[model samples]
Target: MERITERYRLAVRALGKFHELASRDTLNEIERDALIQRFEFSFELIWKCAKELLYVQDGIDAASPKKVIRACRETGLLSDAETEQALKMVDDRNLTTYTYDEAFVASLIGSFPEYDAVMHSWLEKLK
Candidate 1:
């Protein structure tokens, strides 16, 4: 069994958590914080799995999250909008590493649905 399958499985579990959190009308600071963390980890798995699959199948070497997403898009595994949204997720993940500001964190909450959509699409494609 390929590691990509396991990676995708973990990402999907994170995806479920993200969706559960997103569906809430309100989250306390702690829940919101956890949601942010889940998004970060999920996207990490998402891109790295994509990178692994690309390397295995096409000998494509995308060493970074952004590059792997673009490679996935170029190979037709993802659409342009999904690719662009994925890039923003990467940017958001980077932003989360350095801040605990509520306002900044709140802004990123909107990214969950978009991230979820694209990630689920990628999982289906991989399946």
Candidate 2:
């Protein structure tokens, strides 16, 4: 549906911004925080888009990020490995609330590149 398509496009664009920030060689504390925030929003948009597409295209009505991601795997939108990674990504997204913890931020930011790659691949399938 047009709504799903529009949401997919928006999620893709947000992921693009996340990819840009995540690809940085070094970010100051502020930039690192920005990256974390970007990841949070990007993850949110991507999962919601997935939820919408699953509902419209596949008759699934996943109510949360993890559910949407799991449904994605069951529906062949994600491989088992990708599903595992995405589930971990969801954890990372949840942990973003702890951005004040320097160690946690560093660890989470390190995972962004992989998240970006997986998200891009999944978005392509949605497209």
Candidate 3:
């Protein structure tokens, strides 16, 4: 529970940074990469928050990613499409972290706005 709270705080901080970066007009590749990484990390924290909420409220098992995400949808913490996108971002983030390929990173950078929209909407729900 403490960990979940810490994660939520961290995610909120990361989202603040994301907003700061987004406000800038121009970013170099490295800057964009940093922002993308932070964005991905924030999404992971959102997932954790949803899972912890479900676990606390419904006593659902949170060990399995699939189960946690399903519980999130069932509990109205996330929509079906949002859960799917978050899972995809998790997978893509893993690949980007391990592979270090420019093309894929570019693709990820291009997709950042969509992810940001999803995250912002989720955050709004929290508010």
Candidate 4:
């Protein structure tokens, strides 16, 4: 079984990579596509970390993304704005996985900075 600490470290690493790509000033189609992919990965890691932390530290077994995010918000780990954004990201996660729409992809790419900021905040809190 993976320890929560180990899971957190992996989450942090994914978030860091997302930040690394986010800091870049320019990206062509492929790079932007890559960024979206990284966003999906980091997003998954973050919520999983949140779920694990809540389970191990708070005895709150939130099993789904919505449950975990809502619990985190209730515990003050996530803000209203962040909770809202996290929900949106969760929706996008599904879209990114099974569906491919340029508009959906573009919208998510455009939201990268905000998304990155939200994830960055969680990273700091986890640290």
Best by TM-score: 2
In the range 17-72, model 2's lDDT, one tens digit per residue, is 98998998989888887888888888888888899999988899999999999999
* Model 3 worst lDDT window (10 residues): 118-127
Q: Assess each prediction's global lDDT (C-alpha) against the native.
A: 0.83, 0.87, 0.72, 0.85
Task: Show where candidate 2 strays beyond 4 Å.
Answer: none
List TM-score per model, in order.
0.92, 0.95, 0.80, 0.91
- Model 1 segments more than 4 A misplaced: none
The lDDT ranking, best first, is 2, 4, 1, 3
What candidate 4 gets wrong by more than 4 Å, as runs, is none
What does candidate 4's lDDT look like per residue over 1-127, in tens digits?
2676787788888888888888788888888778878998999998988888888778999899999989989988999999998888899887888887888777877788888999888766765
Provide the global lDDT of candidate 3 against the true structure.
0.72
What does the lDDT come to for candidate 4? Answer: 0.85
Task: List the lowest-lDDT window of 10 residues for candidate 2.
Answer: 93-102
Candidate order (TM-score): 2, 1, 4, 3
Residue 104: error of model 3 in Å?
Answer: 0.4
> How many clashes show up per model?
0, 0, 0, 0
Residues 8-80 of candidate 3 have per-residue lDDT tens digits of 7877888878867765677998788778778767777776776676777688868755576667677776687
